[model samples]
Target: MQACGLDFGTSNTAAALPDGTVLPIAPDTAEPRLFRSVLFFPEDERTTYAGAPAITRYLEDNAGRFIQSVKSFLHSRSFRATQVHGRTWTIEELVAVLLRRVREAAGAQTGAPPEAVILGRPAVFSPEPEADALAEQRLRKAAELAGFTHIQFLIEPIAAALAYEAQLSREELVLVADFGAGTTDLTLMRLGPSRRGRPDRKADVVGSTGVRIGGDRFDAELMRHKLLPRFGAGTTYRVRGLSDKRLPVPQHVMAKLLSWHEMSFIREKSTQELLQLMLESSDKPETAEALYDLVMENLGYRLFRTIEATKVQLSREEEATLDFEEARISLHERITRAEFESFCQPLLTELEQCTQGLLERCAGAGEIDAVFLTGGSSQIPAVRKLYVDRFGEARVRTADAFTSVAEGLGRACVSLVSPDLINS
Candidate 1:
């Protein structure tokens, strides 16, 4: 029998089998890759869209009817949505759809229902313990709804550590940094031989801080601040180098720029309507829904692509440039190592402060033997540099960077079957 491990992250879902292999199961539908952790429903009815197709449709419709980043909603005190037909759906129901999809994907891929599964949980939230407990309960229920009989919720950073420990028999105190699209989690753990294979001897959760910002947020910031003014959001301007640069930026473009953030919370509806109208008049007959498609497919989508490209390039080179082929917009950004540090300085500083606070609370820094880094965003040069700078380079390591946690969870699941191996 094959055991399954599920890394249910805010942005993507990946599964690992007992044979030590990991695969990301794409969401069901036309766009067969990546789960946005979002769901949409028509306001007039209770129908809901989960995973990839729903994301694409929500982007195209932009009717304010979509529920995005549902994991984030898990942190909310209580969430109730009033649909178009005066119907309301709780956050738990929205999460049910997302988990149900994951269950279907995992079951379909392996041809076996997962015997026992490991899931990721956040370490901290604004409302303190209440938010933490709520997130935990919601996920457990979501897992149950997804058809999993047994569920184990592990701190995300610790899971990453277990993933790292399986690869090494050595005992060390390590810090694990798990950066995802939604938040950044740091854990200082002592990995050693115990009855539990690579068990966490004394783990200290330093901090899990979220800026309500990520690659998506940065892209929207850039588009709103830099691209809109000149792109004719009801007004037009000639391109810097081309005389034919006069073109309208459709409303869909603006909607895509918004992505999953909530900017209209305090703004009046009329103001939002005016903003929407200006965005519409700028380009063509682009609808809000259509603009979401553009945001996911083009604008907000493209901005993050550029950010990711720059992040990857910076890991290898000193500078990077962004080129928007369809829009004919290109910028050659010469980023020095120092300049790159400055770009992410605030976020990195916040992370460091968080780490320091956690360390202060959990004995001392010397107690931590090693620091591990995982997750897609953990690849950011600034993030790695901050950890290396704090803890010596020799003490910082990455197991499988991207797949460590999910892999560890798989191993942990196997240990459950043979209690003796957990202590081995």
Candidate 2:
């Protein structure tokens, strides 16, 4: 059976073939492997664009609605449906569109649609059991709608472990840490060359745990601390009734701006009216004007992309500068690695607690031979320090930060269909 593994991540997506080849899907963009998980709907046209084209169209023309991180809304009860270009779309319907694109690209490469697929999913979709169940159901529905006849799921971290295990020649205990745009997942499993062909290896998994905090949270922290303040986040304005009395601008508006999925809500007429009222009563009229222009011109995504790029740059250097000038919002600031680490301290603490909990659950299962890290956020210096501080630096192994899970999932597909092929 021809099959593939799909990693439909929060910020990006990737696919792999059963033979361990990373599928090249994005023919439309320069970055062939990393497909942006974004969609753009033009107001006057019936056509929709995904991946790089979607981002390009959104940046070039402000008339269309740009939706990103659609995977994040799988479990959102409040996000039942949204209207785009006069058509109502449920979250599943939008996700199905993305899935279909991926399937089409993979089919084009292989001359046929995959007969079956191994889909990478988070270990825990939500903290609540019912919500998690609903999230899985929605994902399954989206996969079915995308034209897959058979689908199987593998916990994301576990799949990464499988990819790492393929390099092992002897039995070893491994702990896999996968940090993505939306979540951080950890898994402890026993792996070796011998276990590669096993049909029933459930017992090999010792423990697994996850927390809903990752790259997006860091980007939001950057926005809240550095960017938003320049755009009237904490500035004050006088009450219309009393000239002497002043109240701080509503922080909730800034909160929405920091959020990736909720920024679109600020474009509504009611919010704009409220912003205009706040602008009139503001002590700093210029800041208010910039804030008003920001939402009015629909520049939230562009700002976010700038913030995200800064974060990525900080991961590689000791210092990075954020300079955003668009829609009459001009701001430039220099950020040091120390400051970025300080901003993300609380989240790092949560990640430590989550990993410790998983360790406790896997207690008495001999020493962990190696700790494997994957995902884009894993490249962050502070994030890497978390695992290195716990398990010595020498014990940690890293590979293909973004595509490891998808590659592992593809390996899992081979094991499912032709166990002998994997062994060979």
Predicted structure 1, TM vs. truth: 0.71
lDDT of 1 by residue, 136-157 (tens): 8877887887777667766677
TM-score top scorer: 2
lDDT of all predictions? 0.59, 0.86
For model 1, where is the 10-residue window of minimal lDDT?
Answer: 415-424
Worst 10 residues of 2 by lDDT: 415-424
lDDT of 2 by residue, 330-379 (tens): 98899998998998899999999999998988799999999999999999
